[model samples]
Target chain A: MSPLVIAFLVLALLICGSALSMLWTKNLLHAALAMFLTMLGLAGLYVLAYADVLAVAHLLVYVGGVLILILFGIMLTNQTNQTNQTNQTDTASSKNHLMTRESSRLLPLSIGLSFFLGLFWLFTKGPWMNNLPVTGDSKLKEVGLGLLTEYAFPFELAGVFLLIALIGATFVAKNHD
Target chain B: MTDIPVLYFLWVSAFLFATGLTILLLKKNTIFVLMGIELILNAANLNLVAFSKNDPSMQGLYLSLFVLVVGVCEMAIALAIILQVYRNYRAIDVDQFKSEF
Candidate 1:
C-alpha cells in the first residue's frame, strides 16, 4: 500500500473511533469532544480525497461555527428540576450538568450494527465502484471559479437563504412574553 | 502513490450514517439527535467529495459545498428551535413532552 493509502487508513480509524465514542459516551461534553476529533479526521479525509477547499470549509463551518452552536444549545437546555429544589444541589455538579439521558443500549447498538453491515455488503457488491485515478491537484481555484461562473446563481441563493435562516432563528429564539 | 479507492470513503460514510441513525433513535435529547443529523449530513458530503475527486466536471464537489451551507443553516434554525422548546417545555428531552389531552 502507498503512503497515501496508509494515511487514509489512519484518518479513517480516527473518524470511526471517535464517532463510536460519541455514541458510547453519555456525557454531552465528552460526546462533543469526540465529535471534534471526528470532524478533524473528516477534514483530513477530505484532503486525502483532494478536496482541500472543502476540508478548510468543513473545519471552519463545523468546528468554528456548528460546534459552538451545539455547545450553547447544551448549555441553554440543561435539565434542571423546578419542583424538586432539594435535589438541585446534587445535580449542580459539573459532572452531571449535561449528561442527557438515552434509551436502551442493546437495541440501538444492534440496529446500528445491522445497518452498517448491510450497507457495507451492498456497497462492496454494487457495480458503481470506479477505478478512475484521483486528481491530486488542489481544487481551490476550480471551486472558486465555478462558484463565480457556473454556480453563481445558486451561490447567491444560498447566501440569501442563510441570511433568512439566521434572522428567523433569532426571531424564534427571542423572548415573546 | 496509488489513488485511494472510492470504496473506502463509501465504507466510512456508511458507518457514519448508521451511527447517526442509531444516535437519533437512542438519544432522547434533541441536541444529541441534532448532532446525529449533522453526522449523517457530513457522511453524505464525504461521499460527494470522494466521488468528485475523480470526475472531470466536479459537479459533486459544488453540490457538496451547497450541502455544507444548507447544513449550517439547518443547524442554526434547529438550535434556535431547540432553545425555544426549552423555554416552553423546561426540558430538551423529546420523551418528556406531554399533551394536555
Candidate 2:
C-alpha cells in the first residue's frame, strides 16, 4: 500500500477505536476524552480526503470550540452526592467517576453491527465512479470564491444564523431569576 | 494519481453513522447523545467531501461548508438548552427529567 493509504488506514483506526471506546465507557469524562481523540482523527481523515480547509475548520470548531463547551457542560451539570464522595476515595475505582448512564449494550451493539453490515454490503454493490481520479489539490481558493459568488446569499445567511444562535444560547443559558 | 476510492469513504462513513446511531439509542446523558449526533453529521460531511473531490463545480464541498456552520450553531443551542434543563431538574440524563405537565 502507498503511504497515503497507510496514513488513511491509521487515521480511520484512530477514529473508529475512539468512537467505540466512547460507546463502551460509562464515565462521562472518559467519553468526553474519547470524543476529543475521535475529533482529532476525523480532522486527519479530512486532510487525507484533500479537504484541507474543512480539516482546519473541523479542528478549530470541534477540538477548540465544541470540546470546551462539552467540558463546561460536564462541569456545570454534575450532580454531586455526599454519600458517594467517601466511598470514592476509599475504593479509587471508576464506580465513583461521574457516571453517564446507558441502556443494555448488547442490543445496541447488535443493531449497530447489523446496520453497518447492511450499509457495507450496499456500498460495495453500488456502481460508484472509480475511473476518474480526483484532481487532487488544495481547495482553498475554489471554496472561497464559491462562497463569495454563487453561494454568497446562503453564506451570509449562515453568518446571521450563527449570530442568532449565539444570542439565543446566551439568553437560554442565563439564570432566569 | 491514485485518488482514494469513494467507496472506501462511504464504508467508513457508514460505520460512523451506525456507531452514532448506537450512541444515540444507548446513552442516557443528553450531551453524550449530542456527541453522537455530531458523529453522524461528520460522517455525512465526509461523504460529501469525498464525492466532490473530483467535481469541477465542487457543490458538495460548498454544501459541507454550510453544514459545518449549521452544526456549530446547533451545538451551541443544544448545550444551552441542556444547561437550562440541568438548572431546572438538576440532572442531564434524558430519563432523569420528569415533567409536571
Candidate 3:
C-alpha cells in the first residue's frame, strides 16, 4: 500500500464515519458538526484525486459558507416548546436544545443498505477504463483559462444566476407582514 | 505514486448517496433533509472529479464546478424558504405541514 492509498483510506474512513454519525445522531447540532468533519474529509479526498482547486473551493464554500448557513438555520428554527418541556423534566440535558425528531429508523436503514450493495455490485461488475495514463498535474491554469475563454459564457451566466438567487433568497426571507 | 482506482471513488460515492437518501427519508427536520441533499450532490461531484482525473479535456471537472455553484445557489434559496416556512408555521418538522383538507 502506497502513501497515497493510505491517505485515501484514512480520508475515506473519516468521511464515511462522520456521515454515519450524522445519521445516527438525533441532535441537530451534532449532525452539523458531523457534516463539518465530512466536508473536511471530502476536501481531502478531492485533493487526493488531484483536484486541488476544487478541493480549496469546496473547503471554502462548504466549511466557510454552507456550514455557517446551516448553523444559522438550526439556531433560528429551534423548537422552544420542546426545549421548555425538556427543561423541566430533564435538567441535565436542558442546555442541549438542538434535538431533532426523526421517523422510524428500520425501513430507511434497510433501504439505504440495499441501495449501497446494489451500487457496489454494479460498479465492481461494470467494465471500466482502469489503465488510463495518470495525468497528475494541477489544473488551476487550464481551469482559469477555460473559464475566461471557452467557458466564458457559462461562467458569466453562473455569476448572474448566483446574484439572482441571493437577491431572491433575501426577498423571500424578509417578513411579509 | 500509483493512482487510486476510480472504482474506489465510485464505491465511496455510492455509500454517500445511500446515506444521504436514508437521511432524507428518515429525518423529519427540513434542515436535516437539506443536509442530505448536499451529501447527494457532493457524491455526484466526487464521481465527476474522479472520472475527469485521467481525461485531458477535463469536461467532468468543469461540469462539477458548475454543479458546485448551482448547489450553493440551491442551498441558499432552500434555506431561505425554510426560514420563511418556520416563521409562518412556527415549526420546521415536515410532518407539521399537513393540510387541513
Candidate 4:
C-alpha cells in the first residue's frame, strides 16, 4: 500500500478503535481519554484531506479546549463514593467481552450495520464528483480573508451567540447554596 | 479525478456514527452520554470536511466551522447543566433517575 493510504488507515484505525473503546468502557474517565485520542486522529485526517486550517483549529479546539473542559467536568463532578481513583474513570475494560449494554434485541446493531452497508453501497455505485481540481495550499490565508470579508457578519453573530451561551451557562451553574 | 477517494472518509464517518450511537445506548453515566453527543457532532463534521474537499466555494467547510463553534457552546452549557444535576442528585448515572408514577 502507498504511504498516503497507510497514513489514512492508521488514523482511521485510531479514530474507530478509540471510539469503540469509548463505547465499551464503563468508566467515564477512560472514555474521555479515548475521546481525546479520537479527536487527535480526526485532526490528522483533516490534514490529510488538505484542510490544514480545519485540522489546526480542530486540534486547538477539540484537543486543547474541549478535552480540557471535559477533564474539568470529570473533576468537578467527582463520584465521591468510589473507593478507587482508577476505577472511577478507567471503566471495566476486561468485563466487556463481545457484549455491551445493547438497547434492544438485535434492533439497533442490525439497523446500524444495515445503514453502514447501504451507505457503502451507495458510495460505490453513485457517480461521485471526483477528480476536482485541488485548491491552493494556503487555506489559512483564505479562511482569514473569508472570515473578514464574506463571512464577517456570521462570524460576529457566532461570537456574540457564544458569549451569551457562556454567560448563561455560568448563570445556570451558579446556585445560591 | 484525484487519486484520493472520498470513500475512506465516508467509511471513517460511518464507523464514528455507529460508535457514537453505541455509546449513547451503552453508557449509564451522564458525562459518557455527552461524550457520545460529541462523537456524533464530530462524525457530522467529518462528512462536511470530506464534501468540502471538492467544493471550490468552501460552503461545507464554512458550515462545519459554524458547527464547531456551536458544538463548543453546547458542550459548555451541557457540562454546566450536568454539574448542577450532580449537585442536586449526588449521582450522574442515568439509571439512577427513576421515579415511579
Candidate 5:
C-alpha cells in the first residue's frame, strides 16, 4: 500500500479504537482520556485531508480548550457518593447502581456496525464527481480574508455567543443558595 | 498527481458517524453522551471537508468551519448544563432523572 493509504489506515484505527474504548470504559476519567486520543486521531485525519489549518485549529480547540473544559466539568459535577463507596452497609447495592450503564449493549453495537458497513459500501459503489482538481497551498490567508469579509457578521456573533455562554455557565453552575 | 478516491474518506466518515451514534444511544453518563455527540459532529465535518477538497467554490470547507464553531458552542452550553444537573441531582446518569410520580 501507498504511504498515504497507510497513514489513513493508522488514523482510522486510532479514531475507531479510542472511540470504542470511550464507550467500553465506565470510569469517567478513562473515558476522557479516550476522548483525548480520539481528538488526536481526528486532527491527524484533518491534516491528511490537506486541511493543515483546520487540523491545527481542531487540535487547539478540541484537545487544549474543550478537553480541559470537560475535565473541569467532570470534577465540578462529580457525585460524592457514586457507588456510595464509604458506606459499608450499602456497598452491594451501591456497587450495582454504579456499575450499571444505560446502553442497549449488543443491539446498538450491531446496528452501528451495520450502518457503517452499509455506508461504506454505498460510498465505494457510488459515482462521485472526479473532474475537479484540488487547489490552494494553504488556507490561512483565504480563511482570514473570508472570516473578515464574507463571514464577519457570524464571526462576531460567535464571539458574543461565547461571552453569553460563559456568563450563563457561571450562573448555571453557581452553588445553590 | 496521485489522487485518491473521495469514497475512502466518505467511508471513514460513515464509520465514525455510526460509532458516534452508538455511543450517543448506549452511554448513560452525560459527558460520555456529549463525547459521542462530538464524534458525530466531527464525522459530518470530515465529510464536508473531504468533498470540499474537490469543489471549486470550497463550500464544504466553509460549512465545516462554521460547524466547528457550532459544535464548540453546543459543548460549552451542554457541559454547563450537565454541571448544574449534577449539582442538583447528585448523579449524572440519564435514567436517574425522573420528573413526576
Candidate 6:
C-alpha cells in the first residue's frame, strides 16, 4: 500500500470515528470537540484529494470560524435546568451543565445504519469511471484565477452575502428592547 | 502511486450523511440539530470535491466553495435566531417552544 493511500485511510478513520463519537455523546461540549476532530480529519482528506486550497480554506473556515461560533452558541444557550441541578448538587458535577436532551437511541441508530448500508451498496454497484489517471497537481492557481475571472460574479455575490448575513446576525442577536 | 478510489470517498460521505440525519432526528437542542445540518452540507461538499478532482474545468470545486460560504451564512443566521428563541422561551430544546393557545 502506498503512503498516500495509508494517509487517506487514517484520515477517513479519524473522520468517521469522531463523527460517531459526536453522535454517541450527549454532552454538547464533547460533541463540539468531536466535531473539531471531524473537521480536522476532513481537512486532511481534502489535502489527500489534491484540493490543498480547499483544505486550507476548510481548516480556516471550519476550525477557526465555525467551531468557535458553535462553542459560543453552546455557552450562550446554557439550560436553566442543568444550572439548577448543578446548584443543588456538588460542585464537581457543575461541568455537566452541557449535557443535552436526546430522543431514544434505537430508532435513529437503526435508521442511520440502514441508510449507510443502502448508500454503500448503491455507490459500489453504480458504474463510476474507475482507474482514471488521477492528477496530483495543486489546484491553488486555477481556483484563484477561476474565482477572479470566470466565477468573478458569484464570488463578489458571496462576499456581499456574507457581509449582509453578518449584519443581520448582529441585528437579530441584539437585545430587542 | 496508487490514488485513493473515488468509491472510498463516496462511502465515507454516505456514512457522514446518515450520521447527520440521525443527529438531526435524535437531538432536541437546536444547536445540536444545526451541527447535524452542517455535517450533511459537508458530506455533499465532499462528494463535489471528490468528483471534481478529475474534471479539468473544476466546476464541482467552485460549486463546493460557494456551498461553504452559504453554509457559514446559514450557520450564523440560524444561531442568531436560536439565541433569540432562547431569550423568548428560556429553552433551546425543540419541544420547549409550545404555544400558549
Best by DockQ: 1
TM-score of chain A of 1: 0.89
lDDT of 1 by residue, B1-101 (tens): 67888888999999999999999989988888998999999999998998887788899999999999999999999999999888986888888967879
Interface RMSD for candidate number 4?
A: 2.9
Candidate 6: misplaced stretches above 4 Å?
A82-87, A130-134, B99-101
Candidate 4 structure quality by residue, lDDT tens digits, A1-177: 678778889999999899878876756677888999999999998888778788888999999988998888888876645344335455575322212223442665566567667766765676875334334344777778888899999999999999999999899789849
Which residue pairs in model 5 clash with each other? none
**What is the C-alpha lDDT profile of model 1 across A1-177, one tens digit per residue?**
899989999999999999999998878888888999999999999999999999999999999999999988887876655433445666546435456788988998899999999999988888775555566678789899999999999999999999999999999989899
- lDDT per residue, candidate 3, A1-177, as tens digits? 989889999999999999999999988999999999999999998998888989999999999999999999888887766556755677567656577888999999999999999988888887776435345778889988998999999999999999999999999889899
How big is the positional error of residue A9 in model 5, measured in Å on the Cα after superposition? Answer: 1.9
Ranking by DockQ: 1, 3, 6, 2, 5, 4
Clashes of 3: 0
Candidate 4, position A153, lDDT = 99
Model 1 TM-score is 0.93
Per-residue alpha-carbon lDDT of model 5 for A37-108, expressed as tens digits?
989998987777777778887998899988999889877766646355566476555533334266678887
Q: What docking tier does model 4 reach?
A: medium
The residue-level lDDT of candidate 5 at A129 comes to 60
Badly placed stretches (over 4 Å) of model 2 are: A81-96, A130-134, B98-101
Two-chain DockQ for model 1: 0.80
Two-chain DockQ for each candidate model: 0.80, 0.75, 0.77, 0.51, 0.58, 0.76
Stretch of 10 with least lDDT, candidate 2 chain A: A87-96
Residue-by-residue lDDT tens digits, candidate 5, B11-99: 77897899888888788888888988999999999988787777656678777877887788788889888887776777788888778
Which pairs, if any, clash in model 6? Answer: none
Predicted chain B of candidate 5, TM-score versus the true chain B: 0.95
Q: What local distance difference test score does each model get?
A: 0.88, 0.86, 0.90, 0.79, 0.79, 0.89
* Alpha carbon lDDT at B29, candidate 5: 81
Q: Which prediction has more favorable TM-score, 3 or 5?
A: 3
Estimate how well candidate 3 is docked, as a DockQ score: 0.77
For all candidates listed, what's the TM-score of chain B alone?
Answer: 0.94, 0.94, 0.95, 0.92, 0.95, 0.95
Model 6: CAPRI class: medium
